[model samples]
Target chain A: MSQNNLTSVVVGNRASISKPRLGLARKRAIIRFLFILPTLIFLAAMFVFPIIYNMIMSLENYTTISIATGNAPFVGLQNYIQLFQMPLMSQATWNTLEFVIGSILFQVIIGMAMALFFKRDFPFSTFLRTLILLPWLLPLIVTGTIFKWIFDQSHGVLNYILMQLHIIHAPIGWLISPNMALISVIITNIWVGIPFDMVLFHSGLQQIPDELYEASSLDGANRWQQFIHVTIPLLRPVLAIVLMLALIYTLKVFDIIQVMTGGGPANTSQILSTWSYTLSFQDMSFGQGAAVGNIMIVISLFFSYFYLRFTKES
Target chain B: MPRQGLRRSHLTIIGALIVCVMLFPVYWTVTSSLETNTQIFATHPYLITPQFDWQTYRIALQTQLPHLVSSLIIATGTTVLCVLVATPAAYAISHLQFKKVTWLIVALLISQMIPSVSLDNALFIIFNKIGLLNNYFGLMLTDCTFSIPFNILILRAFMQSIPKDILEAAYVDGAGDLRTFIQIILPVSKSVLITAGLFAFLFAWGDFLFSVTMITQNSFQPITVSIYGYISQYSQSWNQMMASAVLASIPAAVLLILSQRYITAGMTSGSVKG
Candidate 1:
């Protein structure tokens, strides 16, 4: 639980160097054990057990009928081998990469801009900040639903606006076209992601001392110069952490893409999540779905290791 | 005077541009929601329509009100469960020096980062086996898996910042650990609790993929799934879908506004990451 993690780190600090008596330390440790044991058990039962069971299930051909008849057969690594053979599975992997990279780059750049804009003492910055939260605070399904409407081929607001502004003479398909569906989903995702990144970066910006800017200015630094020499370096840690977390999150995104496009118009928008769902639930290929899931876990673990190492070094 | 005038003009122009770009989608949603079905499909989307209609809102509300209720129940249930379970665990980790606590927290973090979609097939099997697939408790349990780690991390940061002497004083007064947590820690850490709960509510509410996979019955489906049924590949009920999305987002938006202060602080503290 949250309490144990905090207390453990604090206790691990070892600043109480006077060294308390063994008897007292033992008593405190006992209390700590008693407090945390319940949580560990709960996690083991609900999380660890199911995951381990899932791993086993991945090696076997299990289904509703298999469960009913107790006729499930162990398949070993065939599930993973099937993954590479399936074209859709390979496509899903590629799509996951595209979604993660595209979403993070756009979200971070726009977020950084918004953060800088809001850092100023504007008249309606508070109102703008609240408005920004609208996209993020709304449920992913809701946002996807709204975006689905926006991308509608017929009677879609996007086409309507484009015509009125003379931007495009003909109605452009936003989601229906195989090429445009993924991009439409990406735009909506960027809208949803911008708020979290901006707020974090904005707060990070505030933590940087104004005196640094003043010092830079006195040394003949212009706005761009001050930003390059002062702001970027100062915000690097926050930026790095935010970028890494956002990349990890966007990689696994599911609800929005599914609700909006259903990985449809010929599965152009399918990512790992939807692909996994389709493989296991829809196709009754539980083993393949587990392989996809395992792939996702491995990728995320790789990113987490890199992130932790980077943070430690800094 | 010249420099001031130029600076003012530059800010005004840039600010106006930013506002236009940022508010366009939201503006489009609200405006399109008010338009008639025919007008919504019009090739050129007009910012100001000839007429506004509230019929779509009325229809969506009348037809799918129960689904809205389902969403509220699931969100509230998941948020309450995550906070309750995560709070005690977070408290222990922050204050207790248990063996292998660091590795435990690391495991918690890694568990959170794993995509929920990956678990769908396995979870489906597990739920089907237990006869819990269509139940609210099943949804709540799965949502808790995704929520507890982040909640624990944020709440732990807040609890760790509290002076240890205060806890020792409570101990000196013969206050039990539970008594101290309930009376002292909870009160001081209210903001962090609220922030964590807000995220829990948001995640539970917005999640569509799991809700659709877990609940087969139309009556038990959440608002997200209900709204999803309104759209198709060829043509969608744009007016109704937008109206439903706007309506669904209201509660979450209000929650954010109400806890704006804590939300900001929670973001800052989370990034500090001991």
Candidate 2:
């Protein structure tokens, strides 16, 4: 039955077939194109068109007033220049880098620890591992809200626990103090991010053959030595992918900071994404907002180039 | 091996402790929702609800029910539409020989890194010009910007595993390309379809940036926007706010519980394949 079907399919593809069959072949190609057309149209309209429009909008003097009047005059590089001049822009840039680096470092470290710890099979290890993914799976707004309450100044669980342990003399303003607000959001972000790293590294660890570890042990290697020699070397690809992805994702983070601190304590926690939002919606400077947004895109593009490079290399 | 058994039990206990610490925030959200104003502000916090309390939930539901329904509509609409557009595209990408398909896949991968704010900025203008603003259909369509490419990537990965011979068999039986996809491929790709649809639903349901940007009306606001709104309005009412947070999380939590396997498979495969 299979041989018969294969022969028929092969014959159907022959160019030497009848003219009528040639028509059928053309029709099949058209049908295949039709299958992909809707997706193409959607992407063109939503993704491609908007990105081009965004670049155009960034060069114009667009604002809420201009939007209403429908006359956004072209001002080449003016918006970009203004973006540099804005005081909050530099602060936001620094905060964005800090947020990304701080969150990624701790998330990777803690996630690696958790992954290595849970590498050993034990009763209910799988169940516990799944439970830890709760933070990552929850909506960002939900995570933000939960953390907002957890870091509440007076009645927060963090401060309460610290006070109970006699670790602090007074309630620390986790989200209220300017010096601490960015740190607070980063902590929340790290908590949300750890599970992603953990799961990815967990799977990566599972892929390394057990024999490598056994051999290392047989060679008089301690557990730490085995991990350094056998595990780290083998996990490099997964590690690079995880770091790049975490960077890209963290750089675009908005909801967590927006909800937790509103980039608050006087813009100390403000990042690029939220700053772009404030520029467009709150400040009514749509052109500058688009420029700020374009800046973010450039930064993301830099990271994405590396991401694609790493994924391709791996 | 005998001594290792003792260490394994010790590791399990330690793992349990770690999980407890990590999930404490989730637990606190639930308990805080049940606490009274006095209990919430007490110098010492109650680790558990002192008594059974549902007032916060009652109030939350009374105000936020419409928003939840709005979320359900948008999420479901986005999921259905995303799967519809992406499934056939995924099939074509996997089975058809198109020179440009590789470039298209690269574009799709690049789209994942584009910030939602940038999209929202341009979309706000375009949607306004086209009069799609404040429309559920419009919002649902925009939500697909995130989910459709993701669905295509995942579904294409799954579809590539479907043996070419089976498709050829269908073709030899005089089934058209669409027919082969519908009749032969769709049935086999059921699990992936579910995974893709579930992710689309979750993405749309949890969306905040698009919701705030596109829908300016209170009536059209999804639960995320409503919850954010509730925070500012009822900033003093922590219990009610926590109640709303818990309410907003129920769908995701329920899906996680019921579809743990699919979620894990989807997350792991989606990352690895990308």
Candidate 3:
């Protein structure tokens, strides 16, 4: 009887101790949940919701009319199909590819040159380096506007300078000519993007130890040889990152193009982003616009995947 | 030694020349803003204004001041909202033990890849449904979508560098998580908070895409949209357009000059650490 009583007492103690501990754990979990709840909720409403809604809109015929009527008829794959049929689609796609390629190519080359140049510590080097970032610091609209005037064919400073130097007899249309418009915007983009690339490369260059350079010099390697073998190899990781980021940023470029050309001169300068905007906002073809946006997202995702993989490996 | 000194001086000259070339466009905008309409249209490009004219600036301010004010409010609101939301979440993600933390991080990374244009398309429909269209609150909220993820990532990176012992000491002193965060974490993170806030400010300030898409009303338009509209409307009036562009660029230029270190740190931290 005493043994049974002791056993009952131990069981009662165990249950009583376990109950509050479980409750405390639940309380802690609730508190933890509260901490992240606001961010998760905000992201859900903003990021996740919009993306899902975009996908849904891409599937349906969700035009301004459908929006007004509150009746979006489901038409699976039709919008995507119609996207391919649009004449501007191929041009915009090709232009986007060209823009990304051209912008990245020149930005990296010029930026690398600047980085290598600035690596030598001359007087006012820091001040000059900071000053070089002015183009990047200005808003894209401002850059676009300035470039617009700078390339103004007849009275543009570019023409004035070229004419003064007797480089050309006739004024060259920088933004007006169809063939030159894409190149003009690419030049503007390159200017805006160079500082960003330069800054990253500068940081990367700073990371490479001075000892390595000294060692290369001791082995009778000239500056060019050292740069090719030592600097290039050491800078590869930073280069990969800079190139990927530049690609991603350049891919979604819209402000400059919109301000400069609005992807005009017969849609010759149209990229997927501006074309998407034209389709949805201007033409009110939300479904096709969303389809184009999805296509962009897919492309960005592909790059992002490589970025993630690259970063993981490095 | 003298020859080496001369060579270094030569490098300085070259650097100065490069800087001048880079900054010519910026200088042109300012100078053009101060020039007369006739001078702007002259065949011979005047490096300096023929005559100084403040009329363009006065006109730009007269018409576009309201838009600048709107931009200030929207940018300020976005920064405040982003910091408030991001700080606690960053604290939790970095310090707290949670199973879904990795998923939240992955979500944050993936969110950056989601294009703003795509978000704008869907947000228009949703905001329209709920009467958020043409509203400052709605615009600020949408801007937060971009900054929040970025701010959280930045703040979390900073927060992780804080020693665990300091936070643990607070816990041992009978402080709760909220108090510990406010008293210990926030004070220690002043610099990073400022960095993150500065970036958020710049992001919203320079935003043309969201401002154009979200608010169509002229009165409610941000400076970016206003300047864009001004340029389109006054295509022939180069001076007036340049004046507005100059006006719009001041905030970014000032921030770049003042807090360049923070900006550089914030930018590199995101990519390098990732």
Candidate 4:
């Protein structure tokens, strides 16, 4: 009878001790929630709210009403359909495509060349590598303005230099000409993009084993053979990442074109980003601007999905 | 044997030529910034050295770059706030076993994919409605929209490599989650925090689209829009323009120099194969 009573007393004591420990664990969980509260609040106000607001704006004929009023008539898909009919819209889309393809191709080609050149570990290589980042390091506003001065028709530095060299009989109106304006923009983009690609590719190149190249050469491989067989395969994943990021950066380029031409000589150089800005602010077609922006979002989402998918597969 | 030597010399010469061509645009900008307007108009523009005038630097220094202070304040505030807010959030994502975490990450990724241009029009309207237009707090909040997702992604990767037993041991020692995070996780992850801070700083500092769209007044504008004001469709202020451009590059250049190691390390984190 005494042993049974002692056992009951010990069991009662154990239950009381465990209760407070469970309470402590619950308290810790609640504290963790509080820690994350500020970030959640920030996202709700800035990101989540704005996204919901944009979707609502896309469905209305907000052209006639002041945005401050926020009482525009709903028009369903009218803004989106009308967006496809605008000539500048089509031209802007085309320009964006050309910009992406052209910029990516040249940037990759030239960047690869620089990567190969800088990979030699020669004297002044580190200085040369750092110096090459100057174009990218400078503000885009500065780069665009410098190029603007360089491309000036009469009494500008570019024309003056060309004439001094006797390279051409007369000056070229680089910005005013529609055909040349986009390419001029591409030249600047290429210059800015080369540094990023060089850095990424150089990192990729450094990871490649010298032993592989030595073995290839010993097996009667040429310079081109080593690059094709050994280098390309090793750098494939890095190349994919570099190209995807470069594409995203190029797609959103606005400040340079805005500063250089104001999308001028008849809006020839306008990409989707600048076009959307002009529509909303300059043209006061808020709904149409929202529509254009939606389209850009769709394109970005599509490309990002593909990139994510590709990354997962590889 | 002679042919091989010739080929090697040919490659070196070709490489040198490409480097010069690659460097010409940037070289031209710095050199031109030194030249006077009269010299710039000269038929044979000097590429190397005819004269050096530090007048542009002086003008850039004295021109009352009104937006620089606002930019510095906003960028610095965003960096500090983001590091404080994101460090714990990233730790939770990496270490904790919460149910809704993956969905949160996916949502963040989707938010990032949606371009800033898409949100600009709506945000302009929203800010105008709330009377938050031209407010630094409003702009900083918007920047965090991009910065948080990227910071979370980068930090999670950095944190994943850290062993979990350290935190588990801390938990067994009667310490709570908060104490473990403060003492164990943060000290070890300082480099990654600096890396994320650099990215956030540069993005907020150099952004043109959000600043121009959200902030309407000239005085409220960042250096980007202010610099654009110096250029017009017809007339241009070459001297003041270059001055503004030079001034605008300073914050970003300073950012790059201070965090050069972190930038290189951050780029190689996922890009290069181990």
Clash list (residue pairs), candidate 4: none
lDDT tens string, model 2, A104-221?
A: 9999999999999888888899989988988887889989988889998888989989998999989999999999999999999999999999999999999999888877777888
Worst-scoring 10-residue span by lDDT in model 1 chain B: B1-10
Task: Count clashing residue pairs in model 3.
Answer: 0
lDDT of 1 by residue, B64-169 (tens): 6998899889999999988888888788887755577788777777777777876666777778778989999998877777677778888988888888878876
- Encode model 3's per-residue lDDT on B109-169: one tens digit a residue: 7787777888888888889888999999899898887788888989988888887768766
Tell me how each candidate scores on DockQ against the true complex: 0.50, 0.63, 0.52, 0.45
Per-residue error for A267 in candidate 1, Å, reads 2.5
Error of 1 at A91 (Å): 2.3
State the C-alpha lDDT per candidate.
0.77, 0.88, 0.86, 0.76
How many pairs of residues in model 2 come into backbone collision?
0
Tens digits of lDDT, candidate 3, A95-159:
99999999999999999999999988888888788878878877788889989988988778888
Q: If scored against the real structure, what TM-score would every candidate get? A: 0.91, 0.96, 0.94, 0.89
Candidate 4, backbone clash total: 0
- Indicate which candidate wins on DockQ: 2
TM-score of chain B of each: 0.92, 0.97, 0.95, 0.87
Ranking by DockQ: 2, 3, 1, 4
Instruction: Quote the lDDT for A111 in model 3.
Output: 95
Q: Rank the candidates by TM-score, best first.
A: 2, 3, 1, 4
Note the clash tally of each candidate.
31, 0, 0, 0
lDDT of 4 by residue, A257-304 (tens): 888887777978989988888988898888888888888887887777
Report the Cα lDDT for residue A103, model 1: 88
How well does each candidate reproduce the native contacts, as fnat?
0.54, 0.65, 0.62, 0.52
